[model samples]
Target: MSGLLALLDDVAAIAKLAAAQLDDVAGQASKAGVKAAGVVIDDAAVTPKYVTGLPAARELPIVWKIARASFFNKLVILLPVALLLNAVLPWLLTPLLMIGGAYLCFEGAEKVWHLIIPQKDHGPQQAETLDAAHLEEQRVKGAIKTDFILSAEIMTISLAQIEIDTLWIQAAALAAVAIGITALVYGAVALLVKADDLGVLLSVKGRLAATRAFGRRIVKSMPAVMLVIATIGTVAMLWVGGSIIVHGVHDLGWHLPYEQIKYAAKVAAETLGAANGFVTWAVTAGLDGVIGLAVGFILIPIVTRVIAPVTGWLFPEKT
Candidate 1:
């Protein structure tokens, strides 16, 4: 009887330890996910557009397919690569992060520039008779390729944020983040894509007048909501990208910009008193965004003039 009691106590202790480990993994994963919020928000914001002209019935299915691809990109591909990089060339992490940040900034700035000076549609025009299936395939391929880039950024950012010492713990946290983010992004995309349909259905079929009115409001508001989401995503990309570059520079021993931004934030905080925290954050984010815009604009000309032509030349198609 005493021996049996000892075994029970041992099992209880093991169970407790496992539970504690699980808790730690969850906490770390959540922290990492929070750190990658900018990219995650942009992912959610951007994905809905791929389904825009598709049949309503196909929207959710396409999102599901992309989500599946995103999962594979993160877990099977990016996760392993991230772990390898962390284990081997950890020194390269910051530089890689800055590259990703620069890309984000460039994307945000390009969008802003396009808004300011709307580009003429100069490419070959779409056929009057659209091939729905071909279009769907093209969009899906494009979205998955985009997701691969974003997912790489997300995983890299998440890995950088994880502070655990054990490889297993880090792996667990990254896996959790990958799964959670994929689900969150695609789930939101699905809802955003289908919202109009849901609203139309409710507006037409709702038994209650209030429900019908709410549905009508949803239908009317979706476009504006999408616009708002896109705006936020762009801002987030710039802020996050600029912040990453600034921090990366600081890590690499260039502290002037970092110090200047910190000083400005401090001044704002001091002036705001009770709103110190919020003011400080706002100032910091604003400065970061400005830096991002500057960097992006700088890259735009270089990319358009140099990189694009070079890439085309290097990858010339076979006749």
Candidate 2:
């Protein structure tokens, strides 16, 4: 009887140890996911446009396909590459993240520029002119390619936040971050895209007058909602990109921009004692966004006039 009691206590202790390790993994994953929230938001924001003119029946299906591809991109490709880079070439992580940050800045600034002066080429309309199946295929392929870059950034950012000494714990944390963020972004995308349909259903089929009115409001508001979401995403990208570059440069031994931003945040925080933390973060993000926008504007002409043409010439389409 005494021997049995000892065995029970030992088993309970082992179970408790496993539970503690699991909690550590969860905590790390949550922290890492927060670090990559900006990219995740941008991904959710960007995906809905892919189904712009598709039939309502096709919207969810298309989102599902893209989500599947995004999962594969993050887990099958970026996750392993992130781990390998961390193990074999940890120093490269900061530089690569800076590159991604620059790209994000460029994209965000490009969107702003487009908002100021709308482009002539309507990609969705042009795609819609082709066969529906072909348009779907092309859109999915393009979305996947774009997602690969964003996924790499997300994975790298998440990995950088993890300071776990255990290899298995690091792996577990990364996997959780990847899976959670993918699900979150795609889930949000799905909801946003299907919102119109939901509204239409509610408006046309609801039994109560109030419910129907609410449905109409949803349908009416969807365009504005999408626009707001896009704007937020762009701002987040710029803020995140600028912050990344600032941190990258600081890590690489140039501390002026980062230190100045922190100083600015500190001054703001001092001005608002009660809300110091929030004020500090808001100030830092605002300054970082400005820097990101400045960098993006600089890159635009160089990318368009030089890089684009060169790349096109070097890698002409096979067809």
Candidate 3:
């Protein structure tokens, strides 16, 4: 009886420890997810457009396909690469993050530029001619490729955010974050894509007046919702990109920009007289976004002419 009691106590202790470790992992994962919010927003925003022209019937299926590819990209490809970098080239993380940030800034700035100076569409009209199946395949491939870049950024950001002692903890945190963000983004996309159809059905077929009214409101709200999401995504990308570059510069011993921004934020906070940390942070982020936009605009032409050609050559398509 004594021996059995001792063994039971030991098992209980082990179970308690395991539960503590899981709690720690979940806490870390949530923190990491919050840290990668910008990339998450961009991922969500970019995905919906890929499904835009597809038939309503095909939308969810395409989203599922892309979501699966995104999982593979994050879990299989980017996760291993992130872990390898954490183990081997840890010093490279900041610079690599800065590069990813620069990409975000470039994307955001290009959007703004297009808005400022609309362009005539003169490129090859290839996709419109593609059959439905081919078009679906192409969109899925494109979305997955885009997801790879964004997922890489998200994983790197999440990895950097984790404050853990062991490799296993870091890995678990990253995996959790990756899976959580993927589910949230794709799940939201599925809902958003299907929302209108659901609304129409309810509006036309609902037996209750309130149901029809609710459906009408949903249909009316969708366009504004998309516009708001796009705007939020763009702003987030620029803000996060700029903040990363600023911090990277500080890490590299250039403190001028970081100091100036901090000072400006403090002044703004004092002027507001009691707004709270969120407002101050928002002000700081807006300033950072302006700086990032300027840097991105400068890089755009360089990227278009030089980087694009080099990347294409180095990564020539397989026959």
Candidate 4:
């Protein structure tokens, strides 16, 4: 009887430990996911456009396909690479993160530039003649390729934020973040794509007049909502990118900009007595975004004039 009781107690203790570990994994994963929010928002905002012209029936299916590819990119490719890098060359993380950050800044700045000085479509004005299926496939491929880059950034950011000691714990936390972020991004994309359909159906078929009005409003508001999301995504990219670069510079022993930004934020906080936290954050974000925009503008010319030509030469078929 005593032996059986002891065995039972041991099992219970083990179960408790397992539960605690799971909780820790969940908590850490959530924190890591939050840290990668800027990239994640951009991912969600960018993905919806890929399905824009596709058949209504195919929207969710395409989103699912992209989500599956994103999962593979994160779990199968990036997770292992991140772990390998952590184990073999941890110092590489900062440089790699800064690279990703620079990319985000460039992308965000390009969007802003396009908005300011709308580009003339100089390429041959050709209508897309591809079959629907082929078009869908092409879009899916493009989205997945983009997702791969974004997923690499997300995983690296998550890995950087994790503070746990155990290898297995780190792996579990990363996997959780991967699955969670993929679902969150693709799920939001799916809903955004289908929202119009839902609105149309409600507008036409809803029994209540108010319901119909609400549906019409939804249908009307979608474009503006998407615009807002895109704007937010762009801002997030710039803010996060600039902050990363600034911090990276500091880590590399160039602390001038970082110190200046901090000082500015501190001054702003002191000026705003009641809303000190909000003021500080706003000042920090504003400075970071300005830096990001400047960097991005500098990169745009280099990329368009130098990188594009070299890439075209290297991959002539793609050009």
Candidate 5:
């Protein structure tokens, strides 16, 4: 009886310790996740556009595909790469992040270019002529590639939040953060894409008059909502890309831009008084966006003329 009680006591202590470790991991993950919330919002905002113009039935499937790729990007690719870089060459992370930033600037700039130049509209006729599966493939690839950059940023931010020296604990916390953030982002996207379909169903099938009316309103409102989301997503890409470059240069010891932007925001904040906080943020973001746009314009021709052709020749896209 005494021997059994001793063994039981030992097991109970171990269980308690394990539970405590899990609690610590959870706490760390939550804190790290909060740090990456801005990027998380950007990820959520940017993803829905990929599903736009896709078939209603295919929307959820496309979201699922991108979400899966997001998981792989964070866990299999980014997490290991981040840990390796942090351990061996912490200085390299910022440069790599800036490269991704430049790519974002290019993408956003290209979109703006199309808007300004008003490219030949590929309307329903073009969509009908093209193989939709190929289009789907292209969009999925783009989303996944973009997600990789965003996920890298998120993982790096989470890794920075860790004060723990233990490797396993750090890994556990980062993994948790990655999974949690990805789920939240893609889940919200899935909901946004399906909302119209849900509204249609409700409008057609609901028994109550109010419910049907509400559903009809939702159906009516969704197109505008999607447009707004796309606009926000494009602006966010520019803002995020530009902010990354500004901070990247600052990290590389080019402090003038960062300082100037910060100073302007501060002045605006003082002038605005109670609305200072928002005005300050707006100023900072606006300056960052301008920088991003300039970088984008410079890169657009090079990418379109040189990079695009080289890539097309080398890779030869199927569709």
Candidate 6:
């Protein structure tokens, strides 16, 4: 009986240790996820547009497919690559991050430029060319390609945030963050896209006046909500991109730009003394975004006139 009691105590201790390890893993994973929040927000914001014009029945399925592709991109392709890079070529991470950051800046600036000067939509011309199935496949493929870049950034950022010492722990943390964020972003997209249908059903079939009114409100506000969400995503992309570049520069031994940005942010905060934290953060982010836009605009001409033609010339297509 005494021997049995000793074994029970030993088992209880082992169980407690297991629980503690699990808690640690969860905590680390959550921390890493939060660190990649900007990328996650941008992901959620961008994905909905892919499904915007699809048939209602197909929207969710397409999102599901892309989400699966995103998973494979992060886990199968990116995770192993990130791990290998961490082990072998840690120095390259900063440059790659800067490349991703530049992409974000370019995209954000392009959107703002488009909004300022409304371009002629040749969308109808292209739409007339492709049948529904072909268009769907093209969009999905395009979305997956885009997801690969974003997923790489997400995994890299998450990997950087992890505090674990072992490669396995780091991998697990990254996987957890990738899975969680993908589910969150795509799940939110699925909801946002189908919300109108749900609202219509609720508004028509709701038993109570309050329920109907709430549904009506949802339906009415959807357009504005979508615009706001899209704007948020763009802003986030710019802010995150600028911040990443700043950090990348610092990592690469060029500290001046980063220090200057931080100093500017501090000064801005001091200028608006005692205001809400949001106000301070907004000021900082806005200034950073302006700086990023300037840099991106400067690069635009160089990229378009110089880089594009050079790449085309270097890689002529096969007949």
Top candidate (TM-score):
2
Task: Give the runs in model 6 whose Cα sits over 4 Å from its true position.
Answer: 1-17, 268-284, 306-319
Pull out the clashing pairs in model 2: none
- Rank the candidate models, highest TM-score first: 2, 1, 4, 3, 6, 5
lDDT of each: 0.93, 0.90, 0.89, 0.91, 0.85, 0.82
Error of 6 at 192 (Å): 0.9
Count of backbone clashes, every candidate in sequence: 0, 0, 0, 0, 0, 0
- TM-score of predicted structure 3: 0.93
Q: Residue by residue across 24-73, what tens digits does model 2's lDDT show?
A: 99999999999888898899999998888767788989989988988888
State every prediction's TM-score relative to the real structure: 0.95, 0.95, 0.93, 0.94, 0.81, 0.87
Worst 10 residues of 2 by lDDT: 121-130
Per-residue CA lDDT of candidate 4, range 1-319, in tens? 9999999999999999999999989988999999899999999999998887678999999999999999998899899999999989999999999999898899999999999999886322221566678778778888998999999999988998899867888999999999999999999999999999999999999999999999999999999999999999999999988988898899989999999999999988987787888898899989999999888998999999999899988976441
lDDT of 1 at 289: 97
Q: Candidate 6 clashing pairs?
A: none
In model 5, where do residues sit more than 4 Å from their true spots?
Answer: 1-42, 49-55, 121-142, 157-166
Off by over 4 Å in 3: 1-5, 121-127, 313-319
Weakest ten-residue segment in model 6 by summed lDDT: 275-284
Candidate 5 per-residue C-alpha lDDT over 1-319 given as tens digits, one digit per residue, 9 for 90 to 100: 9999999999999999989988888988999897566577768878887877778889999999999999999999989988888789978878877887787677777778888898875546656766778778878998997898888878876786777767778889999999999999999999988888889889999999999999999999987987776667667767877887999899999999999999999998997787887899899999998888889999999998999899999998665
Q: After the best TM-score superposition of candidate 5, give how far the Cα of residue 73 lies from its true spot, in angstroms.
A: 2.0
What is the per-residue lDDT of model 6 for residues 246-295, given as tens digits with 9 covering 90 to 100?
A: 78878888999777777776777777787747666776677777766876
Report the number of backbone clashes for model 4: 0
